[model samples]
Target: MRRPRPIAPAAGQESVWDYPRPPRVEPVTERVTIRLGGDLIADTRRAVRVLETSHPPVYYLPIADFVRGALVEADGASFCEFKGAARYFDVRNGGTVRRGAAWNYPNPTPGFEALTDRIAVYAASMDECTVGDEIATPQPGGFYGGWVTSSVVGPFKGDPGSLGW
Candidate 1:
């Protein structure tokens, strides 16, 4: 692994800082399982089967896989062009609640309506979660689900940033 270094500006000359990150888009579709409070929170009962000719599929899991009654319904919502509108939830543990930390498509578009009852939440707030056999630790710091191994013009921490120069 290569370490990042900071460069100082040369005297009286314009200096620019650029971090050249290779545009990575791995076509990943492996089974994963997540655990919270010692109970499996989510599992891929089926592979994330999507095609090169179609939009990707994110198969969320039912609440059964998680610790019983650990999630509280939140007031957050979002819209997707290909997956319709989504609802959100807050994860509760020991009187601490992570606000609006997860979201899921309730009534998705016709192309992805199969995830109507499934939920996809942030993998950071949980006590623990897994993707495949890898038990993912809390992300460095972000709100979006980092479980999906794809990129969309990052530095993406907040809302999707500018795409045009």
Candidate 2:
């Protein structure tokens, strides 16, 4: 697949095209929050953001940051070439439950060990997800957990016709 041309980022913004292929996992101090059905699922000043070429950032909050009993382990697992095996969870918010809405790598690959026990939720499954003060837009596919915020520009991977990107 041909790489799409990256949009030029404005001051203080990042272009997804500039991210790396193997992905980089790093700490982000911005407060991240996730809410669903009027119930708070998570709120944290600490999160790990994974940056990969063609994709928006996917934020992973510590499992401890989530509300008690909010994540119920689900069956089936998938492997990420960079992150290793992932386990899914059914996210519960009050009376609402979104199946396989969250996942984690309990044992991440060598360079991505920071992801162990961290939970990454699909923004589309949440009533709201925010990075700092900015509300997040879910990446345009059900399979990816990336969230698009104004600070990042993208001809992102999940959009239609980007399947081979």
Candidate 3:
């Protein structure tokens, strides 16, 4: 399939098209925050991001940053060709519950070991997810967990008819 030309990135912006195909992992120092059901569920400055072509960065936070008792294991699993199998978690705070709102790779594929036990939440499923000063917009489609910020540009994948790209 012929991929569409990437949108030109303005200064200070990164085009998702520029990301690699196999994905790359890198540490991020920006503060990441996740709030669900009107409660702060996770916050951390120590995070990592997975960057892949046509997708926004997915931020993974250390398990220690989550509010105690907020993440309850849920009954579901998903597989990633690059990251290995992932387990789901329901985020509960106060009386609010978001079913299967987060996930973690317990045994990530080699080279992705940094992700093991680090949880990444679905930005769309949370009340708010932010990186630094920008609030995130969740990547389109429910299957992927990428958080779009102002610094990223895209003709991103996951929209209707985007599968062939």
Candidate 4:
């Protein structure tokens, strides 16, 4: 005879039980400095807080924080379901440096409106940047900046799941 699979003792049983749920999530904001050409390009005095489930806190800085004259508008734009629309910029340092390497949200969704007028530049475009005392490195790839350490999360720009740089 063939053996049948055994069922659990509590099959179809329903009962009220007390259990602790996960903690509520909140955004974390911090001040930072982006350095380029031996000068501080951006000083993030006030920026939006970011808290993804698997990622660390990222502060979204405003474009105005950067020296506007230092950045030239690039010929590119992207749409995001969450943040709304984004425009790109080329880091102008002597020559037409990195192209479309940085981006920002001119107008963002109400939930993310705090990022509006904020520019998140390509970390690679600059010589260096710093969050407090810790120096920030270029995020990787030809463009894009998730703004975290490579060891934590890495080389995500040119992945198959992502579009062209």
Among these predictions, the greatest lDDT belongs to 2
User: What do the candidate models score in CA lDDT, each in turn?
Assistant: 0.49, 0.93, 0.91, 0.56
By TM-score, is 3 or 4 better?
Answer: 3
Tens-place lDDT digits, model 3, residues 56-157: 999999999999998999999999999999999998899888899899999999989999879998898899999997899999988889999989998888
Q: Would you list the clashing residue pairs of candidate 2?
A: none
| Residue pairs in clash, model 4 | 62-118, 62-119, 63-119
Q: Give the TM-score of each candidate.
A: 0.57, 0.98, 0.96, 0.64
- Rank list by lDDT: 2, 3, 4, 1
Regions of model 3 farther than 4 Å from truth: none
> What is the TM-score (0 to 1) of candidate 4?
0.64
- Global local distance difference test of model 3: 0.91
Question: Candidate 2, overall lDDT?
Answer: 0.93
Q: How does model 4 fare in lDDT?
A: 0.56
The candidate scoring highest on TM-score is: 2
Report the Cα lDDT for residue 13, model 2: 98
Q: Write the per-residue lDDT of candidate 1 for residues 44-110, one digit (tens) a residue.
A: 6542322211112223565555456667788968875556788888866556567886667767766
Cα lDDT tens digits for candidate 4, 1-165: 222222222533211111112211233344677776777677866765444422223456767777767678889899876678889887765544667767777887667766776667666667776665667665344444545542234223333443532
lDDT of 2 at 124: 98
